[model samples]
Target: MDLDFYKKQALQKQKEHKKFLDGLKKKPPKNLDYQVLETHEETFEEIDCLSCANCCKTTGPLYIEKDIERISKHLRMRQADFEAKFLRVDEDNDKVLQDLPCFFLNDDNTCSIYDVRPKACREYPHTDRKKIYQINNLTIKNTLICPATYVFVEKLRKALEK
Candidate 1:
């Protein structure tokens, strides 16, 4: 995937997407969640996340207590030690990775701790969750970072229109 091209396209459509998403939030279709999940599934069929790990490369996942414990155990490290080594408190007071390109991201764009990755990482872009309309702002922001998100939103818009 040509990330630069997708990023440019997403940037250009930012305002339009935000507007559309806001409208979606106001009064989502009854089956909006279903459509979002369906769209998400189809979008991923064509776009491999390994080909574009911009989300991992550019953004850090919020590490909740359970995630910290799970990942720390998976790596055979003390939770406090793992936190001290790899995480920091963000402005939102959430524990997030200390650096970009995520400390656990291998050279091939695969997560080193794939099985025990953070909940936020497991739900990156978050387009397929229940109550999809509640997270319009996040979905809009993700369009800029994940090409699959961009495609999903565009496809969702079309699906909603008809």
Candidate 2:
């Protein structure tokens, strides 16, 4: 799919989905079935991620202390040097890169340091996992960054309704 088309679709879906979620919050579902349905719907409609690594290109992952150490060590650099050069702690106290389109992301849209990338980077979409309910907030965030989240939620909602 075209990147621009998917980007537009994702943005439109996000707005609609947010409204749906807001409504659900006002009058929460009585059972897990409803939540599952909503998720399925969102999932089924999402765009493919490989075609557009917008998340990697437009945002940085939160790097924990261990990730920072591991990645820095892999780069043959001191932990402090790595932090000074590439990362900073966000207001939420999570270490994140200072800029988007991550420094580790290569021109081909692949992670240059995939083996030692941050935990959050490794778990980008967080939609393919079995335990969907455990990370609703994370899923919501992924909705903005990943088209896969949109597709995953759409599929989940359909399954629930079935």
Candidate 3:
């Protein structure tokens, strides 16, 4: 899928789409998780994340203590130094990146520290997980960031519409 095309489409439809997702959350189908898993699997098979790293480029994932430890160790930096240089405590009291376009994002839209990247980054888009209905708010927001998510939700909406 073309990034700009979906991005434009997402921008245009975000509000209505969010309402759709919210309603889905309120009255989730009995097979909600199964449908999401199937759609997510199919979406990811065709979409290459490297081609569109909008999640890494535009948003910062919450970095926990273990994420700090692993990433610091991988980068050969002291934990304190790493945190000081790259992180700040967000309003939610979560450790998030200090800047946008993520400091660790490479030019090719890959993560500079892929293996040691934060858990949230690894689980991004978060479409294929269990209890999918519980994260409707997040999934709605991700539609703006990830095209695959937009496609997944749109397809699922059609497949299981009430």
RMSD to the hidden true structure, all candidates: 1.1, 4.4, 2.0
lDDT of 2 by residue, 1-162 (tens): 455654566677766666554554565456655455556445545554456788888888888989988999999999999999998889998778998878888887777898998888776676555445556667667766676676665565555456
Give per-residue CA lDDT, model 1, range 105-148, as digits (tens). 99999989999899999988897898877888888789889999
Looking at candidate 3, the ten consecutive residues that score lowest on lDDT are 153-162
Compose the digit string of candidate 3's lDDT tens values, residues 1-162.
Answer: 477888788788778777877776688778888888988998888889999888888899999999999999999999999999999999999999999999999998878899988999889989988877778778877887899998888887787764
Candidate 3: residue pairs that collide: none
Q: How far is candidate 2 from the true structure (C-alpha RMSD, Å)?
A: 4.4
TM for candidate 1 is 0.95
How close to the true structure is residue 95 of candidate 2, measured as C-alpha lDDT?
79
Q: Judged by lDDT, which candidate is best?
A: 1
> How many clashes would you count in candidate 3?
0
How many backbone clashes does every candidate have?
Answer: 0, 23, 0
Q: Between which residue pairs do clashes occur in model 1?
A: none
Model 3 residue runs over 4 Å out of place are: none
Q: Quick one: best TM-score, which candidate?
A: 1
**Where does candidate 2 stray beyond 4 Å?**
7-48
Which of the predicted structures, 1 or 2, would earn the higher lDDT when compared with the native?
A: 1
Q: Tell how far residue 60 is off in model 2, in angstroms.
A: 1.1
TM-score of 3: 0.88
Residue 129 displacement in candidate 3 (angstroms): 1.8
Query: How does residue 52 of candidate 2 score in lDDT?
Result: 76
